[model samples]
Target: MQFFVWAAWLITIANYWFGTKQWDGADFGVIFSTMGISSLFMPTITGIIADKWINAEKLYAILHILYAATMFYLPQVDNPHTFFWVILVAMCFYMPTIALSNSISYTTLKNGNFDVVKNFPPIRVWGTVGFIAAMWITNLTGSKASANQFYIAGVSALFLGIYSFTLPACKPQNLISEKKTFAQKLGLESFKLFADYKMALFFIFSMFLGAALQLTNAYGDVFLDEFKLFPVFAESFVIKYSTIILSISQISETLFILAIPFFLKRFGIKWVIAIAMFAWVLRFGLFAFGDPSANLWMIITSCIVYGMAFDFFNISGSLFVETSTTPKIRSSAQGLFMMMTNGFGAVFGSLISGWMISKYFTTYYTNIGSLSKYVNSEADNAHLLNFLKNKGITVLQNGDLSRALDVKDWHNIWLAFTIYVLVIAIVFVVIFKHKHTRAEVEAINHL
Candidate 1:
């Protein structure tokens, strides 16, 4: 859990708007979207190798080692093109470990005579704790604005890589004697889920929601850091501690996870998910208007509500898939769920959002000394100015025209995303029909 958080916690801040290291949001989008692209096949492909050839633990260890290699080199990546490819290599190895970790946990627990369903949620909560710890570490160590967060993760991955060899072996289920079809041997049978009407709809919507998930991840810290452009809010705690502040959302997300069972019991999947859609509305809306200054509480509240917005749809959606699928396809269905959310959804969201941000919201600037109201972050000033220059924006110095300080139009950008999620909620309510009852809620226990 610590390693996972170390790997992810400060990515947006470290990659997006950090002083000298800042990359274009679109470039960051390309970097981040690689996880989705890799997810298209890596997990399934790796699963095949692990199931038929290598031990799962060994495969996981090697991936982490490779991932660490890429991460350690990230600080030296000065250009967006190189940044794109470097993180792509890292994500390819890192993304598969998500599924592998769950597999390891389940197999290890079961081997010890423990019930996975009952024990896993508690164990999973540690990931959230680790996320918060990582955020705190990044901020406290001043790595939130540096590339050291990647170093932290790289070192952790190295440690984890070596330690993984010590875990119980997870041998392949598809041995030579097992007469499996070529598709089954490749774990491609799950692709058949696309043929089912309900499942097809579910996965489609999962992709849409998955896009929403990437929005906050891509820009939440950038949003907070942007306040440094202003006077009063520049020294504000929220700006100074943007990464830590964003960690509130993850902390809140953890707490909301605990409420899933009760909400599932009472409201069932449909309402729980509807509530989640509504929460996304609130989440982005709050961020749209809230600032690091007076409306800071609204931003904090938005982070708090993120728990409901994220967990209800994602966690509950997993349960929906679980109860809906047969045991044979259950694992694959979950993978499909992840692919829709984290893969296709992430790719779609990142690319579109990145492009949109670059096209419409790219901050234009005049002289560096002009709109830089408070602190003198010349590198950030120069970066944004250079970014606008590349966009062919007309930025001059000293006049009515000189005051052309058109920074990121975050309001419209977020409003667009808010409308996107709102439309998704409305369409979902009308088309996706499920009659939820108390009996349906019983499936949570089986998980």
Candidate 2:
């Protein structure tokens, strides 16, 4: 249920921004920035509360319920400014639950004497399943961009929120049993992990890779719907139900997550992460060339690669931290990992992508008059072709008038992402030296 709330709208918001609200592309940057800003502080603040004052599970439940309530009110707002505030409020409640959920799971596993390394992955896979199911529900009900989708998310969140309260109680360990400084109480001491040269480099690159995480979420659906500009592809399943199509990535995530332990054991973290980085290269490059009709395979393959691209780095990185970091500051280290990837990483990714889209991917074609000015270069022509192909719109390849394609423009965007991934992969290969071993895994579990 937690995963579903995010999956339902994350990918489709760009469609809402560009298509339904007719908002400026730059404004969408500010919209996505809300998640980053919220992430910067909310999780740590909530973590402090869970650690010092309240039961983690109860806090998790309350946040989810609050998130659900805010989501219920989201569809009522029409203005972009109002939507931003509402979504920000929703994120404040929603983001912390991610950390809280992990704490709850880890605590529960430890209490049961079960190996979290061995058991938690299977349980977490269900969350991805939940996410995929919600996407399908939204798509089948024709509510991907409708207010109804919020209600779908809200209702599910409410259930999960309440259900969370019933889970095994997770109490504070009170690691700081004696009087301590403010920084120590807040887990700020974990920042010392940065002093280790290898750990510092790993975190630095994590932030860089984290930036790529939100790119597809911010624009994938918008990219698909942009296809409607072309007459030939607009009515096709990919354009019309792009959110559902993109759900394939989450579906792939569930399967790939199960394979992580094997891959980690066989290849080591460096190779695993390098493969994940290359997967991102394929992901964005595929989008550069794929269309709804002829290149549908490219799109699907990109979605498949997302599993490896995302899970390899995120889950495996977390495990790496788990096995390496001291138990006294393990939770704090995990939060730091998240801060790098989801907080700083998301902020940079959203801001940069928004700028690139507004400045570059958006182009005016002189030949089509008013229509050309509004179309997106990436998917607009494809959409135009889709409309012509499916709806029989007349398209003329003219002699006197020529269509100016944004060839150099989009090439730069893909090139930027490719370079970013390549650099991250190379750095990971050169730095990071920790190896996972049975004894190390056992020590981590004992913690």
Candidate 3:
């Protein structure tokens, strides 16, 4: 339920804005940044509320209900500016629920005398299943580029918000009693984890890596959908089923989530995170070269690698925080993790990428047959190309400028992302230090 609510609109939103609404790409980054902006403080604030006053499950349900109400208003927003504020309001209510859900799951499992490390991944895998289901439903229903996607998500969220109340209760630990320090009473001590060098470094890196998490989500579907503009791929299955094809990544997530226990126990959190970083490099590299015809294998392989890239960092990082923090600040610590990855990191990634794509990689092209003699003539062609070049738009070989179809230099865009992730992986391996041990693996069960 948690997964479906967001998935219905999250992945397909680019299509609605770019393809359907024909909005400027320069403004698109801020839309995704809404998630990050809300994540910046909402999670921590809600975490404090859950730890100090409210029941975590009830708080989570309330947030979802509020989020659903906000989502229902999104379809009525006519411009990017208005949509930004609306989505920001929606995300403020939604982002914190992610951490709360994790906390509720951990608390419930521990209360039932279950092994979190062994049991949590299987349960989490079902979230990915729900995500995949939402994507299929959205795509198959032909709502990918319509306001109907928002309606679908709003209804699902409303249902989930109500349903969350019936789940096992996760009552607050009431760690805010008068005997504690004022900081503890206010639930501010979670911020003190940054005083620890190791935890601080871990969070800094998590923020950097978080930037990479949403890049694909922001553009992957539109990237495939844009291929339809090319005559070669106008009727390709990929164009028709871009959402379902992207859902392959979520499907891969399910398989990898189940493998988290073995990987975590064997490779440890540090190594698992390193592996995930490198997987991002590979995922982008594949997308940089992949196409619908003969090179479709690369696209599929990229989707397969997404499983490792996402689960290894996200699920493993959540567990690492769970085992490392004390009961009093457990929920707060989870919220901190979400803040770093989805908050600060996401803000930088989305804003910068949008600006960069608009300034450097956005191109204009039309069908080959649309070219007139002035552009087709060998002598005038160079002059035309030079004009477009001066305006920061490249004219691909054999492309026509008569109709001026706005497109992207997708190859270079993905290539840039590949290089960025690759550099991060190399630096991380050199500096971030941790050693895997049987004892640390055993400690998870005790936690």
Q: Highest lDDT: which candidate?
A: 3
Model 3 lDDT tens row, 168-197: 988878754457776654446788899987
lDDT of 1 by residue, 125-148 (tens): 888787777777777787766677
Residue 228, candidate 2: how far off, in angstroms?
1.6
Q: Relative to the unseen true structure, what is the C-alpha lDDT of residue 177 in candidate 1, on a scale of 0 to 100?
A: 78
Using lDDT as the yardstick, the better of models 2 and 3 is 3
For candidate 2, write residues 319-360 as lDDT tens digits. Answer: 778776888899889878888888888888888887877787
Note the Cα lDDT for every prediction shown.
0.78, 0.78, 0.84
| TM-score for candidate 3 | 0.84
| Candidate 3 residue spans exceeding 4 A from truth | 51-58, 106-120, 165-197, 319-332, 364-404, 437-439, 444-447
219: Cα error in model 3, Å? 0.6
Clashes of each: 1, 19, 0
Model 1's lDDT to the true fold? 0.78
RMSD in angstroms, all models? 4.4, 5.3, 5.7
